[model samples]
Target chain A: MQFCVIGLGRFGQALAVALANKGHEVLAIDRDEQRVQEIEDRVSQTFILDSTNEKAMKSLGLSEFDWVIIAMSSDLEASILTTMIVKDAGAKRVCAKAATDLHAKILKKLGIDKVVFPEHEMGVRLAEILSSPSIFQFLELAEDYSIAEISSPREFWDKTIRETDARKRYGINIIAIKRKEPYTDEKTGNIDYREELIMAPEPSQKILQGDILVVLGHNKNISKLEKATR
Target chain B: MKQEEIEHLLEEAKFYILNNRFEEAEKYLEKLLKEHPQNIEALFYMGLLNELLNRLTEAREYYEKVIELSPNHEGALEHLSRLQGK
Candidate 1:
């Protein structure tokens, strides 16, 4: 696969590096010579070019690349113009970053369907994390399946894994347990806590208060447990 | 080759997918992909068609290909993320 990224900002650099690491050929471009220099070694190729300039942009032959990503997030005008230039240059697939909902709407209206809002997406995920404090972490697996680490619900305190019947009732498997052990520091004479993880514990493993339940299952079932614990 | 022609073929593949004609959808998508191998929509729909047929690994392959060709595609990333259980 060949990818042409038209901005070498943080997001663009990350995307280019990730794609390049995946063994894909990537052309990383930016108007800033410094930014282009920063990512020159990370991606397949680097260029300092003004993407909004139709003449210069068209010279890149964006159509030959499998994808052209317009990632000028800070400059709305430049981003929009670059999107237009790429499309007009006969690029088959183009994805662009929009600064806001209004920006996204405008991009959509222009028939660019692959507009992304990185900050907005990250904000939503952060909000989800904030709202679900008991869910220590959430990792998506395959379609409909996820593995999540969540603090055990109060109701499950002191109960065995079998007693909770999480596997039977919610169709979720408890993969591990994380417990905090308190210890007093010898030199400082202060009490601290250390996390201990038990992997694939026996069904009889006791669930103590503050124990973090590591579970794996379908998203629906995991959500049931995630919400139930809340 | 032309925009309208490619779109027409995409619609045909979409119709087959919606109608549960898995083989037909695959056939149409394969032909479209042969012409434009990096077509994002075709690869994404091919992922969907594979998912419907219970070929999850194949679905992940197609979705990952779409993401490789075009990063951060919402549907492709969402579906591909779900398959990575670890």
Candidate 2:
């Protein structure tokens, strides 16, 4: 896919690098000369011109790209203006970076294809890890829904995966397991026995102590798992 | 190796922080760091927690670490300067 990313901040630069690395054709643009130079080698092309300038966007032949991403995360005016210009310039898909809920709402209202909240998104992820230690990971699916990976609490230890009635009672589907294995000493060259759990396991699979259970369910259900296990 | 998992964790952490659940937010961040020690999101919020609790030295450490990881990290630089009595 061809991608045009505007605003060469950290987030934008990272996204461009990742996408380009994935073999996609990427055109990275920013008003800052230094920022443009930073991504020069990582992308198919680099531009130091302001994306908000319709003339500049058109001159660059942005219409040839399949997708345009406006990444001016901190500058609302620049982001909005850039989005409008990209759309007017005939980009097939336009994605924008938003700094606030209001900013996102406005961008959506303006018909930007996608609105990303990089800072807010990062903040929420770190918050989850702090709130539920038993839950190794979690993702909000919607307002009331979520998917979580939780450590098997003491109560579930030695029980078979089906015994918990996870799907029936907690509305959680066990997705996978993360197990810690014993390390071998280079001198002794000994392999020690270690515990492991079957991931996306069958109903008959057993749940052992210290096993991390990857699960998917509603937020409330996940919380119940967290409290019960912890 | 889906980025979604890491992204999801960061989102939840931010919500908890906004809700004033400092302790809860800290728990999530710690776990995240254990898995991905170099995660910028986890590092940034650890700084936030220290700053909020008035543990200026610790907060400064985290903020400085963030700048080290991403030199152009405006947020970290801004907060670190504030914490340093600048």
* Model 1: per-residue Cα lDDT over A1-230, one tens digit each: 99998898889989999999999999999989999998799888888988888999888888899888888778889888888888899998888888998999988877785888878766754654566656657766654677888767766777899898888888999999887554444674322245689999899998875577899998788778877765
Off by over 4 Å in 1: A138-148, A154-224, B1-86
TM-score of chain B of 1: 0.92
Tens digits of per-residue lDDT for model 2 on A1-230?
A: 99998988888999999999999999999989999998798799888897777777788777788888988868888888888888887888888889999999999998988888878866776688667655556676666777776767666666787897888877788888765343333564321224465667888887654467888878778888778864
Clashing pairs in model 1, backbone N/Cα/C closer than 3 A: A141-B82, A141-B83, A141-B84, A141-B85, A142-B82, A142-B83, A142-B84, A142-B85, A143-B82, A143-B83
lDDT score for residue B81 of model 2: 74
Scored against the true structure, residue A215 in model 1 reaches a CA lDDT of 90
Compose the digit string of candidate 2's lDDT tens values, residues B1-86. 25887878777777665544445778878878888988986898888765543345677999889889999987688777775641
Model 2: residue A207 alpha-carbon error in angstroms = 1.3
DockQ of each: 0.01, 0.02
